[model samples]
Target: MLYWALVFFVVALIAGVMGFGGIASASAGVAQILFFLFLILFVVAVVMRLARGGAR
Candidate 1:
């Protein structure tokens, strides 16, 4: 998931450099959403692990 966010961020950067405003904006939006989602999931996993006494 983090990888995908990076991918989209690269895409957005390239598109912006190429002056493709619409595509750049869309890709940037996707990247932002993916990054936040990844963060949320990571936090949840950590919380769950700690709750389970850090078994893993």
Candidate 2:
């Protein structure tokens, strides 16, 4: 999911460079959303692991 976020970010950059305003905006939005989702998922996983006594 994080990788997908990076991919979208790069795609947004490229679209912006190529002057596709709408595509760039949409891709950037997707990247931002994915990035946040990835962070939330990672935090949740860590919390669950700690709850299970798996964290040192």
Q: What local distance difference test score does each model get? A: 0.99, 0.98
TM values, all candidates:
0.96, 0.95
TM-score between candidate 2 and the true structure = 0.95
For residues 1-56, what per-residue lDDT tens digits would candidate 1 score against the true structure?
99999999999999999999999999999999999999999999999999989965
Model 2, range 1-56, lDDT digits (tens) per residue? 99999999999999999999999999999999999999999999999999999977
Please report, as a residue range, the 10-residue window in candidate 2 with the lowest summed lDDT: 47-56
Name the regions of candidate 1 deviating beyond 4 angstroms. Answer: none
lDDT of 2 at 25: 100
Steric overlap count per candidate: 0, 0
